[model samples]
Target: MSSDPFEIFLVATPGLEAPLAAEAAGLGFEPEIQPGGLTVHGHWPDIWRANLMLRGATRVLVRIGAFRAMHLAQLDKRARKFPWDQFLRPDVAVRVEATSRKSRVYHAGAITQRFERAISEELGAPIAADAPITIKIRIEDDLCTISLDTTGESLHKRGHKQAVAKAPMRETMAAMFLREMGFDGSQPVLDPMCGSGTFVIEAAEMAAGLVAGRARGFAFEQLAGFDVAALTPLRGAEPVTRPATQFFGSDRDAGAVRMSGENAMRAGVADWVRFETRSVADLQRPEGPAGIVIINPPYGARVGNKGPLYGLHAAMGQVLRDRFAGWRVGIVTSEGGLAKATGLPFQPAGPIVAHGGLKVRLWQTGPLGG
Candidate 1:
């Protein structure tokens, strides 16, 4: 990474950029919501911290260099003289990807080829398609900016949750939604229709102050001058002092309950979270203070029949209104009519979020007056 203030872009899942930026800003980083992600200025340690501690970012990129390249010839000339030795080692392999928009250098394949050859020849680094380190170059309006993807795989993998349900929610999206729903981990979180217990597991981890990336490795570990000694502090486990408050989840499927249990165990928060196989109609709040209740129920696009989903939503709403008084509620679904079928007093629907090629929105309710 660069010395003083390198540009770090936190990739957000399109519609959730604002919440990611808010989470970053709350962590004391100066965050600006850009078109696709949140941009922040930070040094090398900040890069490590963002990858290890940030729950909302899908990937982190460090801008290495930028210039104006009118054509391939100019791009090649600048690429040859660029200081490749500063950031990459001779043995490290890299994959290059390029995008061109409204610029004279419009051929993306040729652009990637230039970077690949340059790194291979000048830096003596091999170019492989499956390399952990990737060089991403963007050419827009004759301006070319080069960045390195410091995150290898997506951060949502999180090295836990080996078991997953169909169309499971990404941990990155779940964390941002939790933040949007004012979840600070101080109170209990219940996901009645929890598919794989994403919300409940995430809440327990947050309350335990667990490092998001501790269980996994990052692309930054493959970078030059990546001292394991220097990265030790960032990887050190903070004392997990979870309060008496517990997180809860229940799904009608016994398989889902078992999967949730296995995932929480791998995440090292099984002691703080509880999961059971129970239908929403039989949903009852456990013994504890009233906390947030969030659910990502199927919207007929994927799982259940449209006709029967209305009754399911109505049953969920009835159970919440009857049992979960003083608890905030948020539901993520694609159908507005289904939300209305709940008969719960909901606030305005939130932004439409893109999920698996479909658009979904979050409808929420304040603490129940019932």
Candidate 2:
């Protein structure tokens, strides 16, 4: 609300800071790298652009302000005096979460309660943990910073997939992987290890100029004083399209293949992609010159077998070299040694994401040089 540029934070995978920052800059806001995200100072328009274009971010948060409090009394007084009506509505339920370091307010629950009371007393809103809106509080070195999560559900839920496999790729990760692979989706795309067809589906959607946020609702809609009508027009824009021979995917598990088919239907992209069931070892190249190929094979930790996964990687590399020359490949894996076992010339990619507590990296190759 203040004319001062509001601080916007974009939470992203650790190694993806550069790409996310570049994306933010492309949207006309210079972004700086923070611990777990990218930080940009901007207004509401900038916030909207971030939601519209960011491919690597998990969530977008706007920082209202920060205050230093030596103790609970100081925290209470400052929090109570700070304006609350600018964002909250009396009818909306809201909750607070706090983290601390070197401050007297060590207990997280106590801090949350006092902060909740301040908001309730000042703005007359009840604290509801199940409320749609969540206010995040961070207390470090006696400095308290408050931010509002503009993205209610994680951005990964693109609202298209009605079903998923055991370990489907999240929409956010799929988008980032596409960018890392230089995918504009003008040419052919394939995902042989496509569990739920997320990569292929996302590529098809992007190629068709479908805006990720267009089909979904955001937490900002519930915030006070939002222009719902303006947002509606943005989401209502028509989708772009091209000929339908571009995207394809396959999986070994029959159930996964069926689930992918259902998901593609729900995403309205069944017409855009071809799905089938085939083991990675038996995967074949598309009947075209060259394009992008992405694979999110089962990591050992998740699937509980490292020996066979190594064989799958070797077989995948062999198939690509022998049959898919001139094609570019992007492989997502959480294990460093296993990625090396593929025996492909790969460059270190954007980030190492925390998927199920294991570090994952995107390993990519240029067009196979025969």
Candidate 3:
């Protein structure tokens, strides 16, 4: 909000902080990883770019200002005097959220109320519970940090995939998991159990060099200091390029396969992706070079009891081992027993990624040998 570039926080899925930081660094950002996210210091342009290109971040936050507030009275006094007019406009609505710790102003509701009143009365902005613009307040060790949520919705929404299957994998997690497998988008990707084709479409988009956030509008567009002229170029959608290699996905259920094709069409990667109604046991390698085969198999909760999943996983592993020569594999599942059932040469991946309230780990294999 100030002339000086504010610190940007890129929130990642809790277990995937490292890969997200690596992604930010790959995009030419100097990022420092914190507990739950990565921190980068850059101007507004970087904020726009981070939202547009970085596929792994769940939210992008800008640290507008910080101050010391010991008590509620002192907090109210300082909040009223803060120069909010420079950043907030009277017409735009705002929502304030606060957290307090190790300070006399321990009441989060009071802190939120004070800031809300300050912005409303002093800055003349209407306070709305569902406002697009959000002001976040964190009071730790008596130091209050005020920040803005530039990304209104979670980045995983991606404005595509209007059609989704049960417990679909988020696009953010798909992108990060692909990155974790060292996928630069050049190699072909196949998801045999592709629900809505999340992995395949994401791979197709990446290989075509598409911008991650191109399909959606962001909260920053509604901010007071937003410069339309400056951001216009960045908002331009790049031409969808033809990928040299292709991506593939398949599901046994006719409805899931149909949904995948529909979602792929919506994502503008339908031409580069192929979806088929094929079960995992019947999966075969497509007409492409050696590539990555990733699948998010159903656990006990979704499909049924764990007893049959072992044989299902074993069949998948055997099919891949026998047919898909020289290909690598990534299997995501909550149970290690299921992953081990694959009987592939899987080396342990780094962290247990949490998805849909279930902890899952990615088991990856190097290229297969003759």
The local distance difference test score of each candidate is 0.89, 0.81, 0.89
Instruction: Kindly indicate the candidate among 2 and 3 with the higher TM-score.
Output: 3
Q: What is the lDDT of residue 170 in candidate 2?
A: 82
Clash count list over all predictions = 0, 0, 0
> Per the 3 Å backbone cut-off, how many clashing residue pairs does candidate 1 have?
0
User: What TM-score number comes out for model 2?
Assistant: 0.93
Q: Write the per-residue lDDT of candidate 3 for residues 64-128, one digit (tens) a residue.
A: 88999878889998999998887677898999999988887788999999999999989999999
RMSD of 2: 1.9
Q: lDDT of candidate 3 vs native? A: 0.89
Instruction: By lDDT, rank the candidates, best first.
Output: 1, 3, 2
Model 3: lDDT of residue 364 = 93
Show where candidate 1 strays beyond 4 Å: none
2 or 3, greater by lDDT:
3
The weakest ten consecutive residues by lDDT in model 2 span 236-245
Model 2: residues >4 Å from true position, as ranges?
241-245, 348-351
Candidate 2, position 165, lDDT: 80
